[model samples]
Target: MSDFLTPKATPETAPFWAGAAEGVLRIQQCDACGRHYFYPRRFCRYCHSTDVRWTTVSGRARLDSYTINHRPLRGTESLSPVIALVQLEEGPRMLTNIVGVEPDPANLVLDMPLTVDFEPRGDMTVPVFRPASTGSAEGTR
Candidate 1:
């Protein structure tokens, strides 16, 4: 499904969407403390500084936690979803969906490695994660 239905975008999230549309997966990095952050914002959550700028990320992440949702909702149709928390290599954890895999809990767990992939929703590209890169494995970051 398209990300337009998931969450509303604001000015703070505009650049993020813009970058996603370009397959760049831009994330916020604090210029002060050199810490990276997800869920796009203007201030660094750690340092309390407004010295934040958009920076390109490798989109490499690990599966911090997740749940396979088998129930259908009003908006979602036939496909079951894997609601997940992706811990990026830069220390920021992001709430996202796990795509291109079977939605099974045993197959997904804490600290499992992950990598990012873009699913096109109209003109925007939403970042979805998959199993971590295994070097020669398919969809490796």
Candidate 2:
């Protein structure tokens, strides 16, 4: 009873998604310069170094920008996926859909901070984002 949109991942990005299943956010970090990146790659795009390794992040980011997509489509009507672009705190932007939220202008606020959560897909875990707590002593930026 679960037919979710499964993203095609390659060797470069597979570890990232796999980590999500274990409740971790994996991003590539330059072993030489300590620069972190998203959309996992073999080489560091920042310093062009092959000395890159996947590291676990805090599973946190911010809503850089988003759109409230109301257009309904087959297979997407029931879920109402909110397509969005998020900016990770480590300094990279990624295209993903937010979950556990209504796709509305009032809900998708620009520059609103967020944190990552995982959704179970058959045999895999996908990373979704949600509003980050801004009030708690542990959540304050």
Q: Write the per-residue lDDT of candidate 2 for residues 1-141, one digit (tens) a residue.
A: 146565666888889878877877888999878899877889988898999998877766788777666775666664436878898888888887787677778888888888887776667777778888766433212
Model 2 misplacement above 4 A: 1-4, 78-80, 135-141
The clash tally of candidate 2 reads 0
TM-scores of the candidates are: 0.85, 0.85
The TM-score obtained by model 2 is: 0.85
Flag clash pairs in model 1.
none
| Model 1 misplacement above 4 A | 1-7, 78-80, 136-141
